[model samples]
Target chain A: MKIPTLHIPDGFISAPVSLLFLVISGFFVFLALRGAKKQLDEKVAPLAGLAAVFIFAMQMINFPVAAGTSGHLIGGALAAILIGPWAGVLAVTVVLIVQALVFADGGLTAIGLNVFIMSVLATLGAWYLFRFFQKIFPKNRIGFLTATAIASYLSVPISALGFTFQFALGGTAAITLDKVLIAMVGVHSVIGIGEAIITVLTISAVLSVRKDLVFGASKLKVSLVR
Target chain B: MSTKRIVQIGLVLSLFVAAFVSFYASANPDGLEFVAEQVGFLDTAKDSATGSSPLADYGLTGFEDERLSVGIAGIIGVLLTAVISFGLFTLIKKR
Candidate 1:
């Protein structure tokens, strides 16, 4: 039996599409680097590194999904909730780069695609979505976890949508875009539930111990005006 | 909890997950692979350029024990990621 890889392999996407994503990923990496530079302090820097290590470790554990399929943590939402968004992007990007270069877990040529969807899109999307939900919910631990759960659940499918868009653009196969999109999103939605649970649990664990270290939960305060 | 304590816990957790629990990971194809197979795009994937690396597919080359191979690989991955990311973040951090 062939061992399964966690990232998009080479040749699944056309050269043009891969190149396009590489360029886009480069641009985002530049932005992420700058953003991380501004956001990371001496105290928070090590946590960001720890987050990357944690994400790398977690990605190795693939929980069984539906029949014949398993899913692992994409970790963007988890990272964003633990660290800030910019540092979260940097953390996951480090994991992707190392996985591609060292472990050969992801295709070297397709590194850009993997980073784009899993790091850039998923990280920022989860962060902003969580922030969006945070405003509506009451400022409390329960509210923070609820928003994180929703954001983490949705982040997987959002990244899947990214993959679908890439497939539509440069798929080497003869498959139709609609079919691919539906299948990818349909399966990932189920996967997202697992993502949500893991993310919420991890966040809850951190919050229970050191609430200040959790970037998302740090801002949450019990309403005094109520 | 102090920052050092938190970092220590995170490191311990990562090592534990990578070195031990990773052995129990499911062997099934992941969601993307499943979709690709169903959509008939699975065949489009080519062998990765570094597919011959000792750590390719998260296994140690020439190791007879599957558990040891994957466990060692996971541990190496965790350590390498920790060093590189920590160094990078520290370097980029403001004075």
Candidate 2:
């Protein structure tokens, strides 16, 4: 059981496919900047930087699960909860760029798609879902954690679906959409549980520290929300 | 300490460590590579020949301990990423 790794290698995708991702990523960065601009007050800048760094650090500690399978923090939701989603998207995109260009973990050509699926899709998708879930849940710790869990889990494969579509359309390989979708969604769902747990625990930790910082923890402010 | 300051310091340190340990990563193929192999496109994966740098493919002249070499490569990656990211952010944003 392998996790849906965000790092797509080169030659696996065509130039046009990679270029499309590149353009999408650049556009998203612009959108992220605009979204972040609203809250980029002098005070928020430092916090934003801290959030970016936190994401970077957390991505490093990937946990092993079920033999060879392992999963790492894709903190898009956590970031969106604290900073706004646009800025959170930017933070994750920046991390991806650094990973590709400087770290060489991800391919340079695929940066756009990586940012699109992993950062933009993950962060924004998770934020919106969390917002929706927060409404129906019990509005307590259980509520917050459960919403966190569901949002994080679903957002992952949704992003993977986006990737599956992209790869099926523009992939260099001769694979079918059905298989790609099946394999991607299946593995990522398991990985999503890990993501959900990390998201819950990390959000809980931050909520305890500076309850003000955890964006999704808003309802928890009621002194003892479940 | 302020969450801001604590986060900044912690980020810098962690990035440093990630970069260093990246140099010694296990040679085992990552999730993507493993899947590519199983799915039948691993061979099609191309390298762009972007640089003349040593240690391409996480190997320094095709060393035997490819995994250790790759881990070390990962560590270096994080360091370079942190430096470049920190520098770019500092230079462009003027924060």
> Judged by lDDT, which candidate is best?
1
lDDT per residue as tens, model 1, B1-95: 88889889989999999988988999899999999898899999998888898889988899888889988998999999999999998898867
Residue B71's lDDT within candidate 1 is 88
Q: Write the per-residue lDDT of candidate 2 for residues B5-90, one digit (tens) a residue.
A: 65666566656544444333333343345456656777876653432345343334444564455445545544554555444333
Question: Model 1 segments beyond 4 Å from truth?
Answer: A1-3, A219-226
TM-score for each model: 0.96, 0.80
For model 2, what is the alpha-carbon lDDT of residue A40? Answer: 45
- Model 2 chain A is weakest, by summed lDDT over 10 consecutive residues, at A1-10
lDDT of 1 at A79: 90
Each prediction's RMSD to truth: 1.9, 4.3
Chain B TM-score against the true chain B, candidate 2: 0.53
Q: For residues A1-226, could you state the per-residue lDDT of candidate 2 as single tens digits? A: 1112337767777889889878987888887776676644444455556566666655655555443544556778777866668767877877776656544446778778788888888899998898888878877777777787888888777776877877886888788767777766766676687778867776776666666555455433544343
Model 2: CA > 4 A from native: A1-6, A65-67, A218-226, B12-30, B48-95
